[model samples]
Target: MSGNDIDVYLEPLVDELKQLWDGVETYDANKGTTFKMRAALIWTISDFPRLKNLSGWNTYSGLACPTSKRRCIGEDADQDDSYWKKRSVFFELPYWKDHMLRHNLDVMHIEQNICDNVVFTILNDSVKSKDNLKASKDLQSMGIRPELWPDEGGKYPSAIFTMSNPQKNVFLKTLQNVVFPDGYSSNITRCVDIRKRKLYGLKSHDCHILMEQLLPILVKNALPSPVSTVIANLSSFFRELCGKAVNPMQLGGLSNHVMQILSRVNDQPVDVTNNIGKTMFPEIGKASRAVSHFGLTLMERDQAHRHVLVNCEAVVPFIDTFRTETKRKLWHQTRSPSKIDRVVHAEFSRWFKRKVPMDSTLHSKEMKLLACGPMQARCFRAYNINGYKFRTITKEDGLKTQNSGVYVSSNTSYASMRDNRVAVGSVPYYGNIVDIIELNYSCHFTVVLFKCIWVDTTTSRGIKQYHLDLTSVNFTRPTHTGDREEDEPYILASKAHLVYYVRGEVDQEWSVAVHVKPRDLYDMGGENEKVEAAAFSPQPGLNMSAAGDISDLQLTREDDIEDPIEDVSDNIDDVA
Candidate 1:
């Protein structure tokens, strides 16, 4: 609507709102009673064009901003009375003139404008380029950047900010090939037209991801160092701004930092980077594979039950007591440490029920339930809980997107070979879930466990952070393969976080680990935390033997090496 058209449409709504504010009788549906009700219109939200129609402001002129008007750009900005279009219909309301806030600009569209301009100007689009001939003429009129002034032929000279044809191709192709985790954003690759050297049909969220995350990575060597650095800094600023939760105290500092980044880009001369590279991979789609299921055998059920018992908190006291009592008896004397551990796990459930009294003061309801032991577990292909969706490797095998990747931070004792002393610290382990099982405790409650294939996290063999935000792991060297009795593969499903590994550009052997945040949950902390990206290291040429089935592996002890028992409770936080 133009001119007073919006006012004509709003007249009836405004009159009704005024009547409601003065106290209109509202009916109580449940009580069948009528009482005086009052309501007030706080604010209206819209984009710049619609905002002008609603607020009777001239958004097309120099004094366009509704909040600051002539003072928006500077105190000396244009403030001519000719800029006035009309008085808003909202001002007709009694409280409208006195209202502190009456309109809010939508940020989604604002992001589009900023992102589109940056991309178009860099790509040097003739149609959408912000640094067109007119812009250069304006610069010439202002007597700044005389080198960028239009020539005698009225043709604008090429600016340093614009990308060369080769550079543009590399940037566009790299962006087109880059892959993101599932549900992170739409297919950004589809938005790029490499042949045309332009981006098209990008949604608001696509621009958001590109501005905050993908742009910095793709711009690395495509642009000059000064330009790329400015882009990186700007992206970082937006990343913090768009974080789940932001600290109000940091806003002043962020504002200053953004201004500095903006000024640096204009002042610094371009130093174009060379050796731009792009990595390409084929896209994957869902594949139909044969799925098989079978009931757990008697021995398999017992082992699964034992795995649950080890991680169960209420059963910890019983395990300690059983271990102590078994040490006193001569039964474990002839058995190896591995065999004894296996025997203890196998027999503990039967012994606990017979030896421990159900109604005893020490045995709480939880303890009693645990002592009775869990029945046979039910396997799942996929399970969702604790704000995460987890799938087994078997289930995710043929899928393009992975939901089976898992990572857990836990505390374990690290024995130093130099001093022969043990030091306990928290270590992050990366892996993929091989199986998911839900064990029932006689209908009282159930516990879900994730059997994972963990990468070797030892000092020489595990995760290595090569640079800031670059972490890599070798999937070939798995740690907990159930090869020895000490290898524990089961962990409480609640403790695992989601992460997906992407193959590195240079090192094909190592994959970059991208951490995925749980959706629909607010951090509620003082600041939004950042997880560094993990890249894989180059693998050594070593032929390792294949691992046998976990359940069929024999339980054996290593005579000299003593495996450290992890202090699980300390490392993990209890998530509700």
Candidate 2:
């Protein structure tokens, strides 16, 4: 029902509450005695606009603050009619008028409205942005923000509050590159469009997450320093307000920040003199190379060392022996398939490492090294090995997917060539690094391994290459992880090459892998180390440059302005 119709439905509940407040005869079963019971309804809750129905207070206009004493505009200029549609039915309860709070507006809708206004305005949405031709005209009529006022030709100039085309692309791209932890939040990337400069389909919780978490990050170097600072402060305020546990002592400080943010958001022309010493322009597109802040415990560290050791090339022979022995021991047990595999993964490494050391016959260097096992291992979310940058899934948060893709090739000798010589065929495995670990073998050497999550890579099931030289992999197809049975999940970090997985243009389940080669590095029949090191480097599109000032940002095209905007679409297109 509509807000006005809600009163009719609440009338019966109000009457029942009044009768209960007057004191009704009741039986006290616990005490085995009769008593009079009394109660009263203190307040009602609803969304903002419904306040008019609950408290008979019109809260639909700019002067809608419930605590204030402002009158809504009437048909005539002189008439002052406070927005009181009718006396609420609850007011019939005589005590209702004396209560301090008659109705409570749900904060959910409040936060949604606040976030929507800020995001839409910053994005300069055609239908939703508040800074349109009418708003500019309003500013002109109010004789304020002269720079934002429409010119003589009725053309709106670029306002400092709204983003230009280049700035918008950067802001959206930052969000597009963000990879949140699993189940932390929904995939917000689907809402962003760098090419169209639009973001839509955000729900209430989505807006809350964006406001409390992402707005501050996106505005960092994309907007002017003053503007970005004010937005960040406002976002912080919302975050604190909506926290699970809020300290009463901090409410005063939070209130103060709200006012400060409001004053700071009022746009003023660039005051070069005031910002002389401070950095006026932001370093656009420059990401920090900060190390990962997470760490593994001692037990986890030890387990990682064992995993590396089993995948080590020097331990291959010993691993095969352990597997054979395990299969022989379990052959007559009638164990389940899963149980047998579990036993192998759990006990094979430990038994082999300990047993091989006690065997005096194993005196070779590789055998001795395998018997002792790898030393305490170091874990990293990102590492540079074989001259190629590798990042774990967690470390890929703000970077292009290039550095995380890992490819390894294995050769099989089975067929004969045209000259009756043995033929070698190469098979490539593709996956993304989930972990990077460095294992130390005494003081003499160290080995880095990339623990990856692989796609099946089989011809008919997982991978396909188009005539256009584009390769796509079906991630839905699973491959055996080394944690289970035979296939090991790890590869020597030195053997991994780099590629980028771009979302497929046609199907969502597939991703196209794009390979990159090192810049200015070529093979001259060199050593394997140099050759592998020359395989990967940063892509050219990642290079970034800084601009001088906020004013240097270009304006939108004339056609884009509903009422004559600056004709700079060509320049905006160039920057994009």
Candidate 3:
């Protein structure tokens, strides 16, 4: 409540306090039973006829006996009865009456209001006519075409839209190279076509940034000389108004009303409150002002941090988060995202059928099944390592195939002759498979297993070797022997992997599938780091000192150097 309304406003709070004070009076009569407001600022009390100003009233002695039992007189105030006994309820409230210092004049609030008032003065409809009139006169003086501007009394658009499209283009072209003063580089970023932007899109800070930081340089050439000078003066006024310290000389133009409002500030620098208006301008202390005055804490940083560190339970999927009940339509048919791989398969099938007819049969389901008959989908025992179950490893040629083994007891590396067997880490450990066993429990499905013996394929690895039965040979294609020496090696059992077949790569004949690992799918990626370390190792001739020395890389200017390619002359004799 600013003026006359102060009495009407304090009624509700006074009633609430009276009831609380009554309860206190019933309990403890000795204790002074009274209630009051915590924090408040009464402004422009002099304007209200019903109110009496508290500022003139002394802190201790001088008294302007207020409307309440509490006497809000000045300190060392003269006790003469000449002081006005106005019926003001502001001094009546013990809360506000007791604490006079808490009643303050907010400098930031006044500055922000002044800025908006200044902005509206230049932009409002009343002033726009005069601005357009002056612009027309200036344009005519410059010999610009009269057709660019509308006739007098026409509905006035903003100053930016007054020019024709070509004129606007010219203005924008020149705006590109507009330079700002030192320490003011923010305008450099806005050196684009701001012609299309509406004035309302700008915030209070944006307005200030344009006026103080950029417009001083921009208006020098872009606007007419008179308009430029006015803008410069306005920017200067704003700069002074929004400054940390107020200058009475800079504030002469402001009316007595504004000056009276400012008079509330009794000291050299006016003090403002923690209202939202003050925090927007940089000259005001922003959020720090609120914290200093009212102990207000902002949670913007806390909220952002909370969002970044959100738990899995708190995270909502994009589809779920923004789901709409309205049935939406699309140009193309929607497919299940979960079965996205199937779409790729269908697309390729259609492509093959249309683009290459003869290859269609080769790409058929029947043909693929014929080649990969034994490689049908089947789950195998996969040993878990590091909490990850890797189903396959890529074969040398990049195909997916199971890691099968044979008993190469003598031929395998790290084999003991006494045991006549190799450990699991050996490549030939699974080389021997003498028998096949099928077992089924009463309540279970068929379980197939290999009953095996050791093998000795010494020719493959310079160890020992032994051949297998015809049945066993077909069952396990142990190609690491005899004339098939160039065949793919038996993948080491140390890198034990389960595998799958490539459907598209299959042929008419039974194709032994080559394994390809999806390296990215594994929790632990492929052993690329280990391979890279060995590849770039220092050569034998170079010592550590030679490699590390800066002097080793000496640059020499070779004046004697000739072009490696001889430039042959046009004449055949000279070319030779």
Candidate 1: tens digits of C-alpha lDDT, residues 220-250: 8798886888888988988888789999988
> Candidate 1: how many backbone clashes?
4
- Higher-TM-score candidate of 1 and 3: 1
The 10-residue segment with the lowest total lDDT in model 2:
413-422
TM of each candidate vs. truth: 0.41, 0.39, 0.23
Best by TM-score: 1
lDDT of 2 by residue, 1-576 (tens): 666777788889888888888888899999999888989987888777777777666676534555433333223356345556666788778588677677887877777788888888988898999889999999999687677889788889877868988889888999889898888889889998777899989888778888899998998878998688888888889899999999998876676467446645653111111212322111111112553333544454445556566555444445555666567678898454454545655676677656556343323434455457665556676666445667778776876555888887766311111112222468677898887766556644556667788877644477887756567887786564544434456677767888778886678889988877743467568456443444332443443345468886667664654665677989899999
lDDT by residue for model 3 (1-576), tens = 354345566678766665554444243347656543233344432312222433343222222224222344433355444454334454444554455542344444444344444333343324423446565566657464354455676543455423344443444455456665777444533535346511233344555665564455554554556555655665665576667798686454443223223322211111111111222112211110111111111232121112121211111121121121011221144533322322321232232223223333212232222112112112223223222233222111253434333232222332222222333343533332222222221212222223232233322332222231111112223332212211122222222333322222442222222333433366465667453344343443333343477777759865758657664565668667
Global lDDT of each candidate: 0.69, 0.67, 0.35
Q: Quote the positional error of residue 70 for candidate 2 in Å.
A: 12
Better of 2 and 3 by lDDT: 2
What shift in Å separates residue 575 of candidate 3 from its native position after superposition?
Answer: 99
User: Which regions in candidate 1 have their CA more than 4 angstroms from the true location?
Assistant: 1-16, 23-37, 47-86, 266-576
Clashing pairs in 1: 471-534, 471-535, 472-535, 513-534
